[model samples]
Target: MLDQTDHDDNEPSAPIDMLEAYYAAHNWEFERHDDEIVASIKGSWTTYELRALWRDDDSVLQFLAFPDIKATDDRRPALYEAIGLVNEQLWIGHFELWSSSGILLYRHAALVDGEEEPMLSLSGAELLVESAIEECERFYPVFQFVLWGGKSPREALAAALVETHGEA
Candidate 1:
């Protein structure tokens, strides 16, 4: 638990310390880029680039997960439709298409108020990162189905949403 007394709104501690501690605790390798930390997370579908950054001005922590796939011009329409459907079902974060590059990414953010406890802020950061990664893993297959398997957007989403039964 983080003690409230350990943090002061006027004299807030550096955000990097909390982020580094969390990554170290999880034993996940990461690279620091100025105020951002970048890591690669391997999922069933593919490796995802996870980037976490803190905007001190806004007191917001943002996490983005980019998968190793790109949508072609023709596939953009279907992919966009699937993205909308998937984003609608997501509890946290939303999928976005980079129109310029045709790359898709999942993005989530946590706002940290200076008045709150540092631990609370750190926890929010962790949740944002975890949620982004989880959502990426959950939806990557749908993108793959549409992009490579020639499945319609609706069919790909349905395939991705299918639930399996446990062994009897």
Candidate 2:
């Protein structure tokens, strides 16, 4: 059962329990600490540390997927530029650099009105997690290009954004 804390007028707030169900149904290993669910998901490009936190006060569930990307202080300017270019091409969610930690993560927030059912259903979580992992897989190499391969932000984005139809 989802634990919902009451907000003003005793309306039910967001719940993180759905994510637990999501993990179980997919047979994915995860640990729940308080209002957060942490899981390591393996993608085609790399593994991602996925964290889903529910904020009862705001009735929002936030998804954070880290692709293990890091950048040196000298390359942060380019890293930021690359993130912006990468975010522009995304239809959902966005990428952020936790400059202090030098880590890059993809973040998306789902909002619930807190009047009816839970904000994020188990089915919804399935889509969110899968989509996030796919996004991380698709763009993990772009960050690699900019941070290590000495590729410009625009160049990296252009190269990764290319879509190939039919495998050779």
Candidate 3:
């Protein structure tokens, strides 16, 4: 029965508490499993499974977004190259491919320490989820171009870098 109103101003909000409040306010559907909150979000190009968890010590908040795409053996090299290229330009979080399952995930972490608890906001949690989705939207086409379109790694990345401008 702990709702948003249950949070006391005098007490520091735990990471999961903040996340629940934020997600509930935004009307996003998620399941709380143990220490993790799992949600399915639809991006521009695909749907992603997003998970948020707090460390056992409650010092770190971790967010991970996994897309539906999986790299095959023949596509692994190009995907790796593209991941490295995309990661270099990112300010927060990084893309990683699990070798065993070829699963690609975007990972980000927010560190909570000292007096920073008072400063945490809902926007911060939203930013973490949004950033992961944005990264996936921005770079997923490169994987598609390389794997399905049979383009070289360089060409695929180049294609993805082409930005479209609309009339303002």
Candidate 4:
């Protein structure tokens, strides 16, 4: 097992570039990379897990797992819930990857909050749902698709906006 606490001095591969190479056939672009996590290519969506021990090298790692068409429904709602907290002091999240059989396998832990009690906490289903919703928003009208239970990117993001701003 790899030591989670070990921080390799090597630079972690840029998630954007890695994702781009993996989905070269689709409309791809780098979105964000903070800390050890990165996201890119809003369209032609596929998730990737590091294939080998990156050891903090110059931004190129292999990851085999991708999005599963089956987990879209059961997981989207939880994802939506997580996105709602993005602006809150308690919100922290990552991309939830799953197998084609609908079983969740991995997640890319990206966001985090440093509050005393940490306001945001999400169920497994919620994480999957949020990741899918995130893709829809980034990919938009060009790559129209929904992965969550009944919430599409349009609905989930809109609701998040409303819930966040509306409550204020």
Candidate with maximal TM-score = 2
- Poorest stretch of ten by lDDT in candidate 1: 1-10
Model 4, position 11: C-alpha lDDT score: 25
Model 2 over residues 24-135: C-alpha lDDT tens digits? 6556789999989998767787777889998877778899999988888999999999999889878989999996888899999987554555555544666788788888
Positional deviation of residue 132's Cα in model 3 after best superposition, in angstroms: 1.1
- Model 3 vs. true fold: TM: 0.84
Q: What digit string (tens of lDDT, one per residue) describes model 1 on residues 68-156?
A: 88999999998999899898898778998999999999888767665654333455546666777778888888999998999998899
lDDT of each: 0.77, 0.79, 0.78, 0.34
Better of 2 and 4 by TM-score: 2
Q: List the residue pairs that clash in candidate 2.
A: none
Cα misplacement distance, residue 136 of candidate 3 (Å)? 1.1
Looking at candidate 4, the ten consecutive residues that score lowest on lDDT are 117-126
Q: Which of 2 and 4 is the better model by lDDT?
A: 2
- Candidate 2 RMSD computed on C-alpha atoms after optimal superposition onto the true structure: 6.1
Clashing pairs in model 3, backbone N/Cα/C closer than 3 A: none
In order of appearance, the predictions have TM-scores of 0.83, 0.86, 0.84, 0.21
Best by lDDT: 2
The CA-based lDDT of model 4 is what?
0.34
C-alpha RMSD for every candidate:
4.4, 6.1, 4.4, 15.9
